[model samples]
Target: MSNKVIKEPSNQLEYIISSKQEHEYSKAVNKLFDLALTYIEDAEKGNRLGRKAAWTQGVFEAPLFYACDTVPISAIDLGRLSSRNSVQIAEEAFDLPKETCSMISVLLGEWVLRNNSSVKRVVAFNNACEPFNMAYELIREQGYDVFRVEGAIRPKLNHDGRLDQVIKFLSGELGDLAVWLTGKQLDESRMAREIARMNRILAKVRTVMELRLKNSLYIKSLPTMFILMGSGHYFGKPDEFEAVLDELIDELNSSDVIPSPLGKVIPLTWIGARGLEFGVYKAVDDCGGALLSWFTPNPYDRNWREDVPPLESMARYILDYFLVGSPVHQIKGIERMIEQSSSKGIFFYHYVGCAFGGVHVEIFRDYFKKRGIPSIGLDGCFQVGAPSGQLLTRVRAFIEMFS
Candidate 1:
């Protein structure tokens, strides 16, 4: 009936990460888990306080739901609880294809377990992989109200006129989504306020990223991932999340942490979606590699422009997302992260059944290969412990090559 039901496993993951070092930033990590617990508890109860709860297909849509005075919970948040079990349930009970994205399968299984869940509204975007689009439809078929925010396709030529049209189109779509959820127009001021709060959180995350790049030894890959992942939905509490970010930033800046010894740790850039298995981080760590930057979430570096109208700014933010843009743009972004982090290679960890990045693994690998930057593509799923021994072996070999 309370968070106690799911708190133990979440804390276990946190303990594993925080136990790695004696940094003060561990306090912030604790805060993040606390926030996630609160959100998960409220979501299970179908609402938070008095706010209506809505399942968000992705993190980017959380801000919009916040503006609408609704609680937005993501599948990523749910999958963090018992991903391996969820995937098994999806396969055995739901009869979902094994080829379905593991994240989607986990979501479906979670939804099934919570059949009595009072939450009925769902918000999703069309820019994601096809599996997600199909998952939304499946959720809708079960009688949950689903509202999708349409995305714009990037044009071949970049021009202000075309860009403006795309923004306008997306703005209208967002406006419609707001009205559908609230039966009233979205308040621009309220949306702007939410954007401002998130921007503050993001600014702090950027500082953490810089700190990690400078001293990768201070915070390990798993903890760094936890921090960046929180920015997606602020773990359902923007104010508290911002405070946690500030604490983390202060700890990183003031701590007397030393960089790793030269030739001891291989600095690498990860260019793919967030990994679900803890072993993935462990494999890299065990292999003497420290991920300096994660490219997928880095698109959040482009903060919402407060100078512009809230709706228009939101549109621009969605359009400028790395996945929504061309492969060339994504590659360019990856190049920048490699250069900035002085990374020795790239780890393209693509999720199985993810058409977004999984299908393009070879392109990224070939591009980096021609440029003399070693890259490896490891196919994985969202289930916990899904990282096979063979996958870890490949990771070890890759790091050994750098050595």
Candidate 2:
């Protein structure tokens, strides 16, 4: 029997899997995902790292969303740039009072609930998200130095100057960590100048990457397979990441793949892993229904809360943009994502993994039923490929019956 909707997901798979041919499993797969854990363990050993973030030569000491998420652990030693963990790492490292920093950490804690382990230090934070911020405090109590990244989001990207400035400052200060982490030194002057440029490139490249993955060429490669892995780190050098991204672009241009479902193409919504990998076009084609998975899909996160950060930074836009008018912020993205389905049915996979998301899938199933969308959650492992074929059949059968 020939399955329909087999156009491979060349563009979207990169977000899920790191490289080409990632659908196939190899012995080294787990090694790729587990690398970040090693760093946290090494740091706990308290001997692998030097006091400073060695940033010389060509190393980029980046910030990560959390100390314990897959990015920090899977990306091991690759320059884990920590996000403010809902707040800046600097404020906590210096012993600032509980304020916004605590709130940030609360969100950070929530983000890390899936498996947080990489953060070595924390910054000052307020209690916005609650007990989550408390975890950072507990980490510091244990004698590890967790620094905070500072500033708040002004609702407008332009007003985020302070945040950007802090990023620049930290990029310089973490110079020592770069050498210690990447094992390379650089010309201080050259490194400093390149930092901003590198920063620019990251933004530019992400934009380019997003656009390219959505193009016509990627559509031809149907039913693509994605193997997921992360080094669990965020910062180091933009050049290296840019190189990986560039390589990805080149690969997508010259590859053949497949997608799922068929062109009755409905929107598919996935809430797991990071804000990458929702092969909307492919999923739409597979199910013969329209599909729309967020870059970082979460159910509870309905608006622009960083706790709600997705590939689309989808928080504000969904509430404001989608015009669905959600009362409980959680409804905007989650409901809207599935509501796009004219087929009145949806198949959701609550990934047992995390790069950037985790919201109650049960919530979706229940709520969508009320709205008449009929959302279903599929059980599976995290990051590794090859979900049960029986499960796939169930999904296909459900879609067929609906169609």
Highest TM-score model number: 1
How high is each candidate's TM-score?
Answer: 0.89, 0.41
lDDT of candidate model 1 versus the reference: 0.73
lDDT of 2 by residue, 32-146 (tens): 2233234334433332344323111111122322211112222212212223242334344434454332323333332243233334433332211233345456655555455
Model 1, runs deviating above 4 Å: 1-25, 46-49, 92-94, 158-160, 258-263
lDDT of 1 by residue, 1-403 (tens): 0112212123335535333333444677566656765766765564735667677744566567789977677767677665447777767765787788877888877876765755777787888777888878877777778888888776766686897788889999999988987889998899988888778777888888888766676677776776767787776677787887888778777877664444577889888777776667766765778998788743556587899998888787877776775666677777877888899988887778877786567678888899999888888777654467788788889888988
lDDT of each: 0.73, 0.35
Scored against the true structure, residue 283 in model 1 reaches a CA lDDT of 64
Native-to-model Cα distance after best TM-score fit, residue 145 in candidate 2, in Å: 2.8
Against the true structure, candidate 2 reaches a TM-score of 0.41
